[model samples]
Target chain A: MLLEIKNLQASVEGKQILHGINLTINEGEIHAIMGPNGSGKSTLSQVLAGRDTYEVNAGEVNFLGKDLLDMEPEERACAGLFMAFQYPVEIPGVNSTYFLKAAYNEMRKSRGLPEVDAMDFLTLVKEKMKIMELDQSLLNRAVNQGFSGGEKKKNEIFQMAVLEPKLAILDETDSGLDIDALKNVSEGVNKLKSKENGFLLITHYQRLLDYIVPDFVHVLYKGKIVRSGTKELALELEERGYDWIIQEASEKSVVA
Target chain B: MMSTTLPTESKEMHPYTERFNQLEASEWALDPSWLNQLRRAGIAHFAEKGIPSIREEEYRFTNLKPIENQTFDFCCGAPVADPGVSQVQGFCFDQLDAYRVVLVNGQFSKDLSDLSGLPEGCIVESLNEAVRNREDLVQGRLGTQVKVDQSSLAALNTAFFGDGLFIHVKKNLILEKPIQIIQLTANGDEGSNPVASHPRLLAIAESGASFSLVERCVGDRDTAYWVNSVSEFFVAPNASVEHLKVQEESLQAYHTAAIQAYLEQDARFTSHSMAVGAGISRNDIHSILDGKNSEAVLNGLYLGQKNQLVDHHTLMDHKQPNCNSHEYYHGILTDDSRGVFNGKIYVHQIAQKTDAIQNSRNLVLSDRATVNSKPQLEIFADDVRCTHGATIGQLDEDSVFYLRARGINEARARRMLIHAFASDVVDRIPYQAVKDYLENILADRFDPKD
Candidate 1:
């Protein structure tokens, strides 16, 4: 198994966001978590990524046979976990090319591999930029500064492609992208997919799953995974909306 | 101004006054008699009013009790051989191809200074040496900008200041190479009993004369000393001047300096002052735009850490009409250090159509770090435009997390964000060599392990 979360409960600033959430993912499997607004989808992803704001009151996450919750955010990244933030931060005056190279070198150093110099790093980044169709000039500008919504999303996926993590949790990566940008972003993600790694995508719409199909789909309602199914579950939710699942989950909670 | 009467022979004098009288009577007495009279009056003025206390509104945030309590061996323009010329050579910006003047222990070093290839109409030499030929010009502009009633420290410097640069640029000539003034403050001659030096610079740029002035204040380690330095610039009509000062004194020393510039009609002046060292430092940057249609830009940055106290007080006097002034200062404080920034923009009633803007921003990294940022604007002109803002904040948590999410550790992530904040002001530097030197210092400071 790539990742296993058992009874995960977390909160932010004393407000409970995640309540006993349980999920599992194996190698090569792409998991799409579908949910309504305020269903703790993003919070779960943040807790797994070791963001300290979402305090884990009770939880245990096992990744690659090691306790994932015991690691720092950078340690998790070094351990092959990646998260594409919902709102990419704009770091003015920090050159994008230098930032990416530093991150890439850090990942390499953590794996006991030789670091790539500037020339070699540029060559590798140029090939990946083609996958996202990003302009070379963006490399010279500050990180995420003055970038359009579509460009920011594409940049996130471009970073995901560069770091090449074992388990990539993409939080709302398709929210702000237009149709063409969404296609390009998904294409970039699809090109990086393989049998050795896994993916956990958190999104509100089913349009993103059409480009990159998921092996299994789950419905999250009120901080808990109330329902679980295969790929058909996503199409069903897309057609009927989330009212049925939310209504069912509330009724089940009352019975318990 | 207070009464300029000299004290009678029966009355006692301040120690600084005694030092001045002793130097004037000893073998170290300067050559010029008129200069001696000026020094005598300056020390008397300082003796009447000692170091500014906390009771003064202008000095409420800073205290000089430590400086008042310690006595230092004064460097009286005498060249020493303890520290070789190689020290000054190694301290300079070698990659910078410019005319350089090196002042060690408040005395000009002839061997290390190079003023060759200067324009025929230009005059650049040590202040003591320049007085022999151009005494009238130097005497005219020396005490014109900063009056004794304005700053007591500057007056005290006028009393003890021995040797510095005196540059008089003729009209319509531009010096391609910047004139680098390197002030290296060494320790006391007898072990480490603490030493003090007062250095000064007088620059006159005539109409249509454009040039760059670079001042680097550095010091040696393993001793405690005090450096009281001052520089005055007289910019004529239609001239341009840019002054860049990087003060990197030792951490165990006390550094206080004043920079005064007088801009005439249609003239342009810009100052970039960066203070990164000194245990207790105060900088007074005062620029007076006395001429109509003149422009002045005052930009400063100070980085402090480890229980240091850095204070900067800036004043922009827009006296005439149709003038524009902009001031931006940023301070980054960590550990138990404290930073104080007080900036004022004063627009007189006659100064109509004046445009002034001032901003003071500070970043405090540690819980113990403190910053007091204040902006004051006094505009009597009804048709003027003035904007001032002050902000004191910490590192943005989201920005830190964004970097950490990309596999960079927490320490390195914070360092990167801090660098980003500092580069906003550093990037404005036009000289690449100076910028590179500052960046290297910043990198070593924030990321020593790298």
Candidate 2:
């Protein structure tokens, strides 16, 4: 198994968000967590990325047989964890090419490998940029500064292609992208997927699931997984919408 | 308002008062009668008000007691201690295609300066030579642009200054190559007594003249020498001047310099002042947009660490209609250092349609490091577009986390952000060599062994 969360609970500013969320994913498995807005989908991604704003209250998250909550964001990243932010941060005066090269070399250094020189790194980054269909000029401009919503999402996927993380968690990567950008992003993800790695897609709609079929689709509500099934479950929910799932979960809680 | 009034206890004898008496009696080179009267007026003002005290409104944040308590030996046309040609290159005046002028201890060095192939009617000589030879050009323009009683330091410079740069571009002439002046101070040979140098530079560009000039103030460490220099520029109608000033004085030195320009109709001037050295340095970079359709751009980048204190005061005076001014100053303070920026955009009543933008951004690294930034906009005209803001903040943690999420470590991420914060001002420079030189310094400072 690549990752296992046993009764994980978290909160921010004295308000609980993710309450006892238990999940597991084996190697080469793609897990999709679909939910309504403010249903703690992004919170789970942020908490997994080691954002300290959410206080992890209890339980354990074991990634690659090591405690994930004990690691810093950089340590988790060096251990092959990457999270594509829903809203990419704009770092002015820092060019995209330099930022990606630095990140690429940093990952290499963490694995006890020699850092790639400028000539080699440029070749790798250009290849990755082509996979995402991002313009070559974007590499020279400031990172995510003055970038459109679609461009920001594409840049995040492009970075994931360069870093080649073990377990990639993409949060709302398809929220603002058009159909063309959505297909391009999905294709990039498909090209990077391997038997040795896993994927966790945190999104609201099942439209993204139609492009990249998930082995197991889980519906998260009130900070807990209310339903889990195969790709057919996603088709059923897309046709029926999330109202039925929320009603079923509430009635079951009332009966209990 | 800038207060020119002396404090109540002004009758006390001051160091400059006694030093002026000694220097005036000594034999020195004389210029025209106007310059003589100007010097006398300057000495008279200096004798009355020796040094600005901390009690004053302007000097409240800056204390000049360390500079005022002791007397600095004003080398009256004395030969300065000479250094080898290699020593000159050590100050980072390396390979650049330009006309070179060198001054040691504020005294002009003819052998060190090269002015060959200068265009006809273009006078690029030392002020010591220009005052006597081209008196017609140097007489009225020298003390006319910058007042003699602007400050006590200016007064002292006017009273005791020896030699400086004097450049005059002919009408409608455009020079492709820049004129670089490197002022080197290595006068520590005068033991016990700290030597002082008051160098004055005067540049006048006739109508439609265009040129680029670079000024560097460099010196060795471990000296308490003072550099009280004044630079005045006069840009006539339809002329343009680009000026770059780099101050890298010793850590134990006191550097007080000013660069004031007068812009005329359709004239344009830009000044980029980068201060990375000096124990206690203060600079006054003021520009008067005096004519219609004139423009001025003043930008600065200052990095200070340890106990160093760097202060800058600027004024963008829009005097006529349709003038424009743009300014950006960013400072990065580390350790227990302090930074101060007081920029004023003064628009006169008749200066209609003035478009001015000023922004001062500072990054104080340590809790002990502080910055006093204020943008004072005094607008009298109703039809003007003036946008002014000042920001003093530390490195953003969100930016750091974003980089760290990409697998970069905490230290390296912070370094990248700090470099980004500092480079925004330096990157705006138009010269590649200057930008590279400055970026290299910032890289070595923030990220060593990279």
List the global CA lDDT of all models: 0.87, 0.87
Q: Write the per-residue lDDT of candidate 2 for residues B341-422, one digit (tens) a residue.
A: 9998999999999999998999988999999898889999999999988999999888888898998888889888988987
Candidate 2 lDDT by residue in tens digits, A1-256: 8899999899999999988899999989999999888889999999999988899999899999999999989889989999999999999989999999888888898899999999999888878876778888888999999999989998998999999889999999999889988998899888888898899999888889878889999999999999999988888888999999999999999999
Clashing pairs in 1: none
Compare the candidates by DockQ and give the number of the best one: 2
lDDT of 1 by residue, B16-122 (tens): 77778778988446467777776776787788788888788888988888888898887776555446667777777768878888888777877888888987888
Task: Give me the runs in candidate 1 sitting further than 4 Å from their true place.
Answer: B1-11, B23-37, B78-82, B191-193, B448-450
Docking class of 2: high
Please report, as a residue range, the 10-residue window in candidate 1 chain B with the lowest summed lDDT: B1-10
Candidate 1 lDDT tens digits, A1-256: 9999999999999999888988999999999998999999999988888888889999899999999999999999988999998999999979999999999999999999999999999899988877678877887999999999888888888999899999999998999888998999899889999999999999999999999899989888879999988889999999999999889988988999
TM-score of 1: 0.94
Give model 2's clash tally. Answer: 0
